[model samples]
Target: MAKHPSLQTSKHQRFWKNRRVFLTGHTGFKGAWLSLWLISVGAKVTGYALKAPTEPNLFELLELRKDMISIVADIRDLGRLKAEMKKAKPDIVIHMAAQPIVRRSYKNPPETYETNVMGTVNLFEAVRACKSVRVVLNITTDKVYENKEIDKAYKESESLGGYDPYSASKACSEIVTASYRHSFFNPNEYGKHKVAVASARAGNVIGGGDWASDRLVPDCVRAVLRGKKIEIRNPGATRPWQYVLDPLNGYLLLCERLYKNGAKFAGAWNIGPDLKDCKSVGWIARKFCDYWGSSKTCSIQKGKHPHEAHFLKLDNLKAKKQLGWYPKWDINEALSKVVEWTKAYESGLGVREISEKQIRDFEGFPQLNDAELY
Candidate 1:
């Protein structure tokens, strides 16, 4: 196993200090976490996205609106998007807004493509018009690759294809990003353009403050909390499970690289867990039950469901070798953290405190330095 890299507080503060960041999908699970991290590190953030998708969402749980500029709008609204980006004049842009559910795509393919594909186009168009932007990272999924269900892990060089609408839409988004990168933000003209463009494909991300439906971890959390049996739809489905901070950390590092190196780091990259962390849905649910000490427990659900890839894994060698990024928490640790966060929520403890503590812990910041950093 490759050794995990240590994140120095000075290194983070030095890079992120006074940096202007324009983040989309800031109301979602991963986006909210990134937003908080950015704010903690002294980055000036302007979050543009629709209202929280769920009633009890992290954005509200953390009370994130008061700290940063929050804009509630649609990604397809090009005019609105352009105006917001122009006003923000961000040094870095992280595009994460999308219809993120796989099963939901089957019910609404048109909406999926419209948001995932056209939304990306609109973001790049806005980026093209904005001169202050130095780096733009589009967040896609590991399912963007064509899955053969083999034992082999997918690499950055893997062929792009998708069986389901959600996956296919993300694949389209990847193509759109590449088109804009080549046609507008060309690497050869980096000196003139002064912009870096890249895409990140991450694995199945599980964390607290995620109340989204049709996901395994959230389902487990909901079930355990409600004293209901956690239903397992596809027990054998295997995926590259990763803690939320693992890839968010990778995003911060990638953005830093793209900002400094420009064209050299402008391309597709995979930010995922080690191969051993990829496990089946049933395995995750069982482990989650164990950690939560759930009395209701889990039960397999029998029904025909939409087609999903049975086995999916990502090869993180490029990120490891070039970016010095590797997964810090394994599957067990990730689940334990989820349990911790969920239990804190159940106990009515201040989530922001626990969240910030977890963030500090994840970054290896000492207790004595809290006064200095925050």
Candidate 2:
């Protein structure tokens, strides 16, 4: 991936610099990355989420608690979340806190609905009351779309449906976002200060520091590191895979556009790699093993595995034409970078330094000075 020329000239830099933002779920994999990136750009971020789920999750590994006002609370706790947002009085809000898994959802359907659906509702209610918030972005998943096993990529206008609890919860969250946007923050009624809302659907993201269970990349990494054969649930399932930062960049870009032009860009946008980059689980595992040079092998899990979509992809034309957003890294580079970070950290190198280096590489920023971050 080529460096994204310095944002020094783009309004994205100035817009993000020193901005007061409320970020829920900063303890999760993608949230940790977003929090770190926001801090790097000088955003004053207040993170609200429960403690890391796993012992060695990215949030704890990177020590993200030091950089922001880390609020260790569940999003379902409306009173606590509301008070935090009120006190923070953020200029923007990004809701990412949720139960983000498919098979896990089947295992714990009620918990998934409570977090993904009710949690989103609570966040939107809080945002509605927080007058200081000018723009909001609710992060959903590509699974929010109703899948029919068609070969074509899904567009934003497609019907919203999900066969699994996790996907359905996210689809419900999307509805809640749209309902709140139109019912509460509609520019035609409440005007711009009411807070513009946009939802983003991202692809299957893989990167370092993600140790979540039931995920392909993390499972591969763990098995490789442990000299165990990785288990593949759906080897033939094809997904639009991209580096975690790719969709994150799109989210930031979406926020910028919504902040600048209220209703013009206020809607759902898809963030994913091109269709050709989409690959099967077996293919991804082989590539990861090749990059790590670990002799780990992957075989389809025996017995029952939860149902997952066989093929899924997102059409990103809307975001590209409207927000001028495009994926920076291809699959090869994305996987290589992930392996690079995992290997470096596993080798007893400074994890934080390696993470920051990858971040700099992704954003095209110059290597950080010693004083910036270690």
> Can you tell me which runs of candidate 1 are displaced by over 4 Å?
1-10, 365-374
After superposing candidate 2 on the true structure, give the runs of residues whose Cα lies further than 4 Å from its correct spot: 1-12, 190-192, 365-374
Q: How much is the lDDT of residue 271 in candidate 1?
A: 97
* Candidate 1 lDDT: 0.90
Q: Write the per-residue lDDT of candidate 1 for residues 296-320, one digit (tens) a residue.
A: 6668887888899999999998998
What are the lDDT figures for the candidates, one per model? 0.90, 0.86
In candidate 2, position 162 carries an lDDT of 97
| Winning candidate number (lDDT) | 1
The TM-score between candidate 2 and the true structure equals: 0.93
